[model samples]
Target: MVIMKKMWKNNQARRSVSQLLMAVVAILLLGYLSSFVYFRLDLTADKRYTLSEPTRSLLKDLDKQVFIRVYLEGDMPIGLKRMRRSIKEMLDEMRVVAGSRLAYDFVNPSEEKDARLRQEFHNSLMEKGLKPVDVVESKQEGGTDTRRVFPGVIIHYGSKNIAVNLLSNNPVLSSEENLNQSLQALEYKLMHAISSLVADTVKKVAFVEGHGELGYLDVLDITDELARYYEVYRGFIDTQSPNLDEYAVVIVARPTGKFTEEEKFILDQYIMNGGKVLWLIDAVTVNRDSLSTGETTLALVNETNLEDMLFRYGARVNPVLFKDLQCALIPVNTAPAGEQPRFVPAPWPYYPLLAPRKDHPITRNLNFIKAEYSGTIDTVGTSQAVRKTVLLVSSRYARLVRVPSFISLRQIDEKPVQEEYNQSFQTVSLLMEGKFQSVFTHRMTGKYALPPGKTFREQSLPTAMIVVADGDLIRNEVRGRGSNPHPLPLGYDRYMQQTFGNKDFLMNAVNYLTDDAGLMPLRVRELRLLLLDRARIMESGTFWKTCNLVAPVLLVVLFGVLVNIIRKRKYGRPEKFG
Candidate 1:
């Protein structure tokens, strides 16, 4: 019996040693194989952590180191803290794909002890285009305190740097909703800034300026914004020697004068060569300056002579003014015009706050677009080859007024009947794409010939164009008078002192039209907004806390007890009566 026990102990020891050796060898093999064949699984319902194919491609192709400094650190509200966490996680994922090409750090500007030095640093950041957001916090013992936070990032690639603002401050949306929207756009915003800096060639964009369009001062803001990603040029469409095949995109912003046949032909031929155009044309005209001096202005048809061309391409800007009950406010005197002219903001139906469509990538997650004297667009053709997407639409309570009608400030005091404002979802902005048919294809093209050495084709290569019925959509407000006037930000309302999404809308439109790497699709990503139930936490707080603290200890104890019983049953039992 003693010899048998000793032999059994020796066999058990050898078995233990052999099992340990096998486990070690298996782990070593796994570690070696993992280096060559790697994969990660995102079990999240929305696949939030999975990077889009375009983003992965862009990161993999990055040749230089891209460093990012995010200034959304320090103590902030719960919502902002969540956003910061998301930013960190996103950067971590990017690093995994980009390896050494991407790096990022979180910085707190408020950590500086010296007040003057911090202020200087803040000013420098502002100069770099990082806007600050004020956070109002309730004090523990007293009233409240206000802190300024810059929720933005500066990306450095090669020798170029660009700033991207992470927060979307839309007053129309609640704080939570805005944060969710901002998170949805986080990927696109970062990728767009990086792509612009790392691009090998900067494309040229021409702002067509021949026909009394908004001049340098009027479009100064958009021009400056486009300069970050494109080479901007302003010139006339030469009627004598018509040629515009060089520009990638031609923008006709708020042209008040009509286009000549030769100029239109030049644009049509340019489109035939797979060029892009953004046309902000006013089908109906109302003199807003005239209304400033008086209470009323006559709305008339503004003829730019490009109607036939647009119809052939796929859309028509109607000669009617769109008025919506859901509109912006304008200041008007209500005290009989004599009591010191007490001005108060009132709803101006003609100045509609256009709603952006969420389905398209160009307008996804965008704020309300502010427009003045905007008209509706109608898609006019049955061409299956062309696809027309509506980017902006009026509210359900929209009313259309024909040209030759008087627009009076008295309309604000006059109550609108509910029945009269029943038109729903009138198209304000449209995007048309495909092989566009030339306007002069069926007409006399002998008079409209391209410059020598250039070819004119009736059918275009795959092309795209955006038509915004409101011309003033791209025009910025001016603060001062005459030559010294300062241009305000585009889509900024002087009365409300709020900036709308006109800039973002235009930027996305241009990017979508010119995108070659499929990056715009990243803008449509949606993340699940998971929120804790405060009421449930308050009601069952103690029960859940106790379970969390005690359950794991209980589970470990039960597991150990079960293991001991199994061991005893297997090893402590008397030898079977052999």
Candidate 2:
């Protein structure tokens, strides 16, 4: 009897030791996991995330202390409320990512709109050099309107401020894949925008002038936003051309007059000096100054021959009109005198809203480059020459019209089938990167001074973009002044009630051309992936069955079996699990 009692005591001691060991291991394992996870999964899929690297870096190097006053209070739009949660998630991520390098304070501007608080926000905008975007009172539910003020985010590094505009019309949210891609890009965009604003190296982009090019007002109206990122300047290279090396990139936008040999030579020299050019040229004359079309009219085909300069580089802009069945409709035939409209504007055949390719940094997030009177661009590959990529294209059924006479918006029709129509796709926009011979290398013209640089020809010139298709959609169709958008870009369908993508497109292109840091501009992220195969929905039954009936029964059976095993183990019976 005494021996039996001693055996029981020994077993009890062993069991207690094992339980203690298990508890200690559980605690250590959990501690290790908690270190890696700083932020919780609190954001919704409808929102996003990013960090301001400039503010972060400055806090470490310059030791600058910054403050941000977010004017969001009261109730948020349901969508915006979800966004607020996402913003918190992103802010937490930034805090963890920056560690001791940054500190910030989030504030509510509705605190009585007090003089001190209002003054603080205004002072921050001025002192930090941030752009101040006004918030408009818009219509809400219940026959009432509400006044709300907010922007995407703001970063203050030293005295420089980088304000990010998040709310824009996004057409891509139509596709889940596209939305995922864009979110991926958002991270890098936030990083680069903030960093570039604070970086020591300032980039200069000059608009080439004196050849009847589009004036600064034409683009600066839009590029004033650009001036914030690049040093915008007016540049010309006649015989009186100044130092071409002053700029990192030169812009040539719709230069109507012919280029004098000397003038062309100076530009050629600039390219040889490692300067990049963003050539937004049009082969066909588009009457953007016409009436009824908001000064925009489309026409086609010319041999005013720019190929002499471009062909040597392996890409040529053809003066052919691109027509397609898949096109935007403009009202052609309206409702008769007192009847519902019987005829709608048939696709204008030529204004092929060139669909952007899913690949490539520039056109990846780019959609329907809303251009009118666009021309076909031909790319001919060569050896010991530059590389070319088609950033935009029309549908496979697209037709090209050759010029015999002037064609108006009403002259569009289906073209006869041709081999070119079925054979291959035509390129609308191209990228060129390689050597180029100076147009004035063989000819001496006194019109130009001894070139901007020593080189007569550029050998292996840097990469640059040449968009042959005109940016006709760039015309401010919506009539709004200040920062408030007037009418939003027409939706892809009526269901897409957001406007972020269109604005993002312009901003993304500018970022791609100037910053090409492979920051994943087109990639996006999507969490809460719930893919319910509709084919099996009926078979899976309703939520109540799946969550309550079926799940509970399975759990109860599992619990009963587990209890039985434990009970048997306590009594020293043969263990079922073992």
Candidate 3:
């Protein structure tokens, strides 16, 4: 009987041991499977997801397959590493919205050892029209050693290619904020370009000629840049017989001649018919750009009748000149190049450094717009679809001197002349938005508008942009020397190489204006920086070093000890000294 009982006990112990081993195997298998599943472990607090409506809509509605190729090398700079990491993190966030429509690959150019494969890769990228980026690395040695590294990206779908300019694939624009902004833009820009490439459904914009409007050649930079996205046309709007539907947007550039009532009626009807316009009007334009800095005092030169139409729109263009606290740097008349460079400190004449309103989209992320002989505009009677926002304003410390004046360069003008001219900020550039109730709204109640008898009707606002400050600093005043000014950069010419962020500002303007709020917001992206300043660490070196090295270990040790004590008291034993 004893032998039988021992046998039974032995059998039961063996069965229990076998079951425990099986349970361990099952747990291991379960852990392995779960580890392979998609689990995001984001270390950045800022990277925690925040869904934007526009991004989600674009991703969900994307029809074509967008294949993205991320070119990377095994070795990279630290800054570049940080940037790439940020890019990847942003890409992961994008995946949430992009779903499977956005396909990506991190290509290791070094992986393919075969000569044919390498050649094929290069040819494929080129065939897709992706720009080849040549990266050069110099070894720190007696003899400089150089290596060619290609780091870039290619976005493509159904033969349409949009190569994003990856300037210095290093961390040049590498911040989390920048990465997010770029990614947000990626789908929208690519879609817009691909749509353009596949379908030639281009929108038309015009630069008005005649009436002393800055000649088309003067704004070559603007036109050229705009050419990438618009069918840019250069012409004049005849107030007598205007073709309002000729273009989606119209540019009434610096006009010197006053419009007749008939001309004013045509413009009014155009606005009522939903015509988009960009008005660059001048008030007191002084040509004393060079001499004004000399012994010349302020001179007021009237270009021509500019205020009639603006006044009709509920704002009067100031005929009086403005000397604002916000100013720009102009080249003082210089001696011969070889002579001691003598550039006198001269205030840019009426070239008010426009302070952009942060609330608006067109002026967001803009540093400053340099304009000469610019004027201020004020709202008159309220018009429909006529919500005007201040695009640019002068500093509070500004004063206006009337026309027929000369800039007295040597007039004790160290400080601005204190004048009681409203003592409030006056707007130089104004943005008109919403469905503007046309001046012809009362007239155009019936059918399409006709001449002699006017038609007034309210119209929907086009994705439009305008700046009613008459100056060409932002315009490419200079054209190519060989031919008529082709365009300074964006199919429009600038007068000079002032590098005043004009092109960038204009592009951002177009982007913002054309951008759908549910697609992508072109407003500026801001990033808050917390610098881990080395000086602070160096000052409290010992304590910092200890905190960096031993603090985490100490925390873990304390936690583990507390856990053990709790476990012992709760389940194992009573804490008795004995």
Candidate 4:
């Protein structure tokens, strides 16, 4: 009996040790597996915490360390604080994919106690291309205080660095809406900056300038903007042999004259070689200079000779002018001529404020695009291979005026009946993609002599083009009050002092055309903002405060009571031996 008891005790001890070992091994295994597998569940309705696939891929392909310095820290307004929080979250998510390759720091340049030091810091940031914004804070007592802040970031990768402005300000939008748009665009802006810095080669873009297109001074703003990402060139298409092979994209902005057969053939063959083009053409030409004299002008149809070419390629620029009820304003002289002229803002129907289509990435979430005597675009031909998307359209109350119509400034004083403005959603800009048939295919034999040793191509390689019916869409007004003429922003309205989305729209179109890695699609990621009703919040502040203060404590107490009851029931039962 003693031997049996000893053997039983030894077996019991071994079993107990085995159980302990198994528990230890399970814990170690779980710890090891967790190190390799990492994931985050985005529970927000807008998926605000989710990183885009392009961002993940970009981070995963990092070859060197990327360092970022964000100058958005310190005590500020609530909106700025929220922006700072968003930046931190985005960087944390990026770090997960980039591992140790990505590093970032939040800095407050205004933290220096000395005024001179702070100014110096601000100047340095500005020299590095960071823009400063003046923020005003309302004091609790009665007054207000102003603070200059740089809501921007500088990204450094290898030997290159790029600056990104975190705030997207649209004068037309409310402050809250602008802040929301800034937050929504954070991902695209950051990713674009990173991609630009890491690019191996700079792309080439040219502005076609032969056919009385907009002068260099008119397109100065867009030229300077595009110069940041590309090697911009200004030249006419070669008549002998227009080899556009060196350029990734060509911009034919606001051509006023017709093209010769040779020039058309060259452009056709260039498309056949897989080149992208942005056609900013006006179907109808109205003399704005005549309008300045307070006289009516006849809008005549322009014969650019490229309509047949465009029609063959699956779209046509109609020769009709569009007027929308949702239009821009211009200052008009309401006072008598003898008395000092009092300028008052009056709605100008000819200047339509086009809203972007929400479906396309190029125009999604963009503000109004200012148009002056803009024409309509019609998709033609039944080619299944070509894809057409309208990027910009008129509002619900719009009307079309045919060519040879009269335009007078006196129309501003006459208010039209809303019922008469029946036309709605006229397409002003279009994006076309696919293989295109050459307009010169049938007429290539005799009309246009082929250049020596060059064969005419009947069909084009897969390519893309953007057609905008308004030529003035790409032109910037020049302000000449000072000694030197300063070009205004692309979509700025002097009367309202507001800038529209013209610059962003054109930039997006170019980026979409040149993008090969599908990064431009990141602009489509939408993060909806939930805002509180100010009046309701103010009226029910006490009730909300009381609930917030008392609810958590009550829940904790109730949870504790329930747990105690469960614990007592689980352990208080009588023990039974098996």
Q: TM-score of each candidate?
A: 0.91, 0.72, 0.71, 0.87
Q: Give all candidates' CA lDDT scores.
A: 0.89, 0.57, 0.59, 0.87
Q: Highest lDDT: which candidate?
A: 1
Question: Which 10 consecutive positions of candidate 2 have the poorest summed lDDT?
Answer: 491-500
- Stretches > 4 Å off in candidate 2: 2-97, 103-151, 166-168, 172-182, 286-306, 329-347, 412-425, 435-437, 440-457, 471-506, 520-531, 534-545, 548-564, 567-578
Best by TM-score: 1
Count: clashes, candidate 2: 18
Model 1 lDDT per residue over 1-578, tens place: 76776677678768868999999999999999998753678999988888888899999999989999999899899989999999998898888999989999999978888999989999999999899998999999999998889999999998899999999888788788889888888888899888888899888899998788998898999998988789999999886786677787899998888898888898988898899999999988888777775468999999999999999999999999978998999887777654577778988999999999987899987889999999999999899889999999999999888889998888787998878999889999999989999887867777766867877688999989999999899999888858789999999897888899999999999999899888898888888777778899999999999999999999999999999998677556655324
Candidate 3, residue 356: how far the Cα is off, in Å = 1.9
With candidate 1 superimposed using the best TM-score fit, by how many Å does residue 289's alpha carbon deviate from the native? 2.7
Model 1 lDDT, residue 350, Cα:
91
TM-score-wise, the better of 2 and 3 is 2
Q: How many residue pairs collide in each prediction?
A: 0, 18, 58, 0
RMSD after CA superposition, every candidate: 3.0, 7.3, 6.9, 5.0
How well does candidate 3 match the true structure in TM-score terms?
0.71
